[model samples]
Target: MKIQHFTNQLHLLKEDESTTRKGAFIVLSAICLVGCLTFVSLAVDIGYINLVKTRMQNAVDAAALAAAQEITNAVNTAPVGTADVTQYSRDQARIAAKDVASLNDVFIDKQIDVIFGRRSFNESTQEFDVTWNASPSNVVKVIARRDNNDTSAQDGKLKLFFAGVTGDRYSTIVAQAVAYVESRDIVVVHDFSRSMNFDSYFNNESSARLSDSQIEQNLELVWNDLQMPNTGSLAFTPQYLTTTKSDYGVSATVTFKYDDLEVTSAGEIEKVQVKYTDNSYQTFNGLSGNSVNINGSKNIETAWVTARGPSENEPVTVTNNGISVTYAANRKSATMSSPQRIRELYVGFTDNSTDYRSYGSNGPYNASYSSWKEMDYMYLEVLDGRSYWYYFNAPNGGNEVTLQFDDSNWEVKQAFGLTGSYPYPRGSWDGFINHARNYSEFSSRGFRETYGGLTLMNYILRDYPGHWETPDLWKTRHFPFHAIKEGHLLLCDFLEDLGFDDHLGMVSYDTSHRQEKTMYDSDPNVPSVNISSEPITDNYQAIRDLMQYKQAAHYSYATNMGGGLEDGIQMILDNSRAGARRTILLMTDGNTNTMDSGASSSLPHGWDWDELFDYDGDGNSDYYTNSSQRRYVLRTAYDAVQNGITVHTMSVGIDADRNLMRAIAHLAGGHFIDVPGGASVADMESEVEQAFHRIASFVPPAKLMNQD
Candidate 1:
């Protein structure tokens, strides 16, 4: 009976123990399942949250940059002093940020804050600060936030499955970013019109006139004004002839023909014709003649005489009875009761064959002299009457003389008026010496100063192999500045050596404005551009080609400073290049002669000239003077500064308005480089190139404020 009772109790105890074990197992399994679910939720949901946060950060960053860019665009496009906080909010930046922020399923709880203020980097503290609401805000900042309280961002809140069991429903996330407008896009406004031909020293075209005079003076110095004769002396011993009267009581008349004049090989007078009319005249060559009448003149005698020269080739011939030659002379002279009268004289050039080069055959005098070695300069006098002298330069001699004559009759012909200006001075020592001295000095000084800027620029930009051989010395010595002489520069080859990659563009203006080159192609409609609005490339060769071939426009003598500034500013007002700093290199070598017309109907987007600079209050076409142009430049610069565009001014020569350039630089918050007036064209080129380098090397002081 006891054994049976103990077994029943054991069985009951076993049943209770089984029940306790089952309950404990069930409780532990429930806890394990709950813990596993919590771990899975933490891994997957937390990963997703982290990813969302990354995307949100990117969105905010983009938002900040967009906002900053909008401010820049506003400043660039709006008229000077017209950009405000309202314009910033209305710009594409705010809209761009909002769109980007929503890309990652993150939405802002409220409108993004677009703040325009000053952003500065503190060197002492090594920190950046952005002060909000600063007047004339040049920096743009954007702040974006999201929480569950905002319906738009609530969908992106961290949703937890197991974490809810821990009494947590969702996790809130927020992201913020800031960006400051910086200047990067640059437009180099260069003067390439005809007037750039003006000198760096003087202000107007008067200098060019002086240059021309100097050229003429130098030419004279080289050829005409020499103190010493370039060619050998022309001095020659003269010969004399005396004709004695055979009959002292009777008077005699003489007639000399043009055919009898002769010259020796040494350019000395050798033979001359003499005639006398007298019964007592005696001839030296045994010839006798009665009273001769010439051209209706009675009582005329004739004789052919030879002067005593080194060569005794011919004998003297004279009429006999009335006159006799006591002694032979180069020129014939007669001692007669009646004085002799010269009716005419002739001069000509002879060929090597001693044949006359007739005036008809020889062409002009200078032409005849070039072909023939010998020329006869003749002189004649009518006793106690007017004397006449000339250089007879005729091809077939002259067809007619003072007396009836022909080319074949005589080699000599009377020359009437043959004096004129000469390429090289000749004749008297006074005129020749004066011109020769002046020409010599002028040649030493070199030719006229180079005037055309395009020509000079082409020389400066040429490639040279010698530059690389000694690169260090080339740069240190500023070789380009020193190497220019007579418009040639040895430093031209160094342009390729510079190897710079800065984005470059050009704007040329005179009476009108034209976009020469741009970082981005803005004019696709123009036939030259096949692709519309194509991004600018880094092709230095192409850039150089544009500069070399197409930089300068036609000569419009007018200078429109306001128009150029407006166009240059337009080049940097691009939204695609936002977040990059904008700059304008305004280089001018002259004053203003025209002004911008506030007409936007004929312009493209970003080409609103009136919006950029309004010189006259009338709001119509108005001409700007020097003073008004300066005001316009300053006003444009002010607008650029407010829009974060730095404008650097380079007054290449004296004519470039100095004070205006300084003011523009000051107001635009850009570096002012005075390549300062008074440099030669070559020197201006060197300094201008150096100024470009300075601008390229310049690092804008910390454009980003509080950058992380």
Candidate 2:
């Protein structure tokens, strides 16, 4: 019985052991499966988090950049000190950010916060700070952080898919930018003509009638406001004064005098005065006398002595005590005597009033009174309405005007002329008028007017910013390459503003004149050749030399054979290497006929006969002859263009050869412009500006690099 019980127990134990092993294996397998699932979950979750972070960062960056760009644009467009500019900037930033987000197909989960502040560097803190929360936040806290900062690593942030996995987690982004005031130095040149200075009829009687005091006052005002550098202070320098007169027969003279007088006794005194009987009187003072005489008799009296005269055909004579003294008139000469020693004498006779008139070498006669009046205390009159007269005391012996005889009881009064017409020469004034007319004609025909009213200095000033820094301020008798280099990039001035036209006129007028000449030369009947052609050879090359020289020539000419060609090519290459893409602006009148190299052509053979006849030949010519020289120019230009340069051509004038200009422009990958050639320089400058702006707009901003 005992043996049978033990065997049953062993069997049971074996079964129990097997059951335990199986249970353990099942538990282990369950643990492994669970661990694998957890690992997979973590990987998926992290990947989603990363994707959200990237999208948020990208959105923030785009928004920041857009906002910055908006600020820049608004600042550029708004006038200084305008209150609305800040608002406009904010609005632009909001719109730009919104647009950027929309383009990226992302939605901003939170409001964007934008803040603007002035950039400040704190020495004590050793940190740079920009004001934040200064502007209204539209999406998030737009913390403007420096690019160097760690916290601002991400420009902006958007909460996207990561919230589900990271428990509503958010990211921070900061934008960094630089802002500073930009300034450009400018030079301004203006014409300083009498007409520009004051409103006055051209040599009208009214203009001539202005008094010396009035003229002096007007001139002083103009001088004070002259806008010269270092003026208005006590240390200011006076400008050199020059005068030109209208009359050819009348001599021009200017005199400066200083007066020093003292009052001895306030009383009426008889004075002996000297007189020059021919020339106009200049001045007198109480210093020198031959003798004291009265009416050619020997006498001494307490008289006020006066001296005067550029006498009328007689010598200057002094009489005292029955004795007479005479002196010949000399240029820049004078005499003097004491005021109490001689009688006052007026060399030229005055009618009833103090006004003196020219008697035309006849006799003492009356003449028409001028509108100008002389002060009673003044010892001067306007003779012939042009010349001046003066009175002075002979006793002082110096050139001086004295106020010794003041009729103390006489009140200051103005003198006027009667309305009745006076005898006057009909055509005597015509000569003066004709001279004025001729002056206007010559001035108009000169380069000052012909080049669309552009002065050489004006062109330099307008075109170049660095021109002002040149040692000579770009002022040279001859065209200088230094000036051209200084101003070449200043083509901005030619752009158009709201009210200004383009600068096309400047190029047009010059080109048109050249075209006409070329056309005339091609004609067979016209003078075949001329000596003027000698200077015309290699003109274009000369121009290139002038543009590239260290000490450049003023006149533009063609380049010379070796160095000139090398220099021009190098210039273009250097500019390109430096990332300054060049755009050539060729202005022509469309007639491009030029001489063939080594061809047996006459002096003017390069000109177009057909065009010349068109200009003045009354439809006698059948076919139009083209310009070979112009074609050469075009080919040369095209070669440059094909080698990575762009060329734009403008044809001005009615006779512009559109076909040729269009072909050149097309080959060079540029547009052709046609406009009136006679436009003003200001207009031409505007046109050039416009073309540049147009070209610039099409170019990608990434290609632009600042050179200055």
Give the residue spans of candidate 1 off by over 4 A.
1-183, 200-501, 518-532, 535-537, 550-555, 599-626, 702-708
Error of 2 at 112 (Å): 10
Error of 2 at 678 (Å): 9.0
TM-score of 1: 0.35
User: Each model's TM-score?
Assistant: 0.35, 0.34
lDDT of 2 by residue, 473-579 (tens): 22222111222222323333212111011111111111111111111223243332221322212122222222222122111222111122122233344322222
> All models: lDDT?
0.42, 0.32
For model 1, the run of ten residues with the poorest summed lDDT: 409-418
RMSD of 1: 22.8
Task: For candidate 2, report its TM-score.
Answer: 0.34
- Total clashing residue pairs per candidate? 51, 111
Task: List, residue by residue over 1-708, the lDDT tens digit for candidate 1.
Answer: 999999999999999999999999999999998988888878767887777678877777776666565544543345656445345444555566566666755565324355556554433763445577764444656555445554445444565555676666576777677666443445667665434533311223424333534322222222222222222221111011112221111113222221121112111222323333333333233222323222312222344333221223222222222212211222122121112333333433333233332333222312111222432222222232334332222112111111111211011111111123222221322332222222332223331111122111112112111222111111211212221111111112222221112244556777677666532222342223211142232333444433332322232446777678787777667421534457777866667656677622132235333543344455542222236555565566666776777888776554567666765675576777776533233445566665665655453442335565
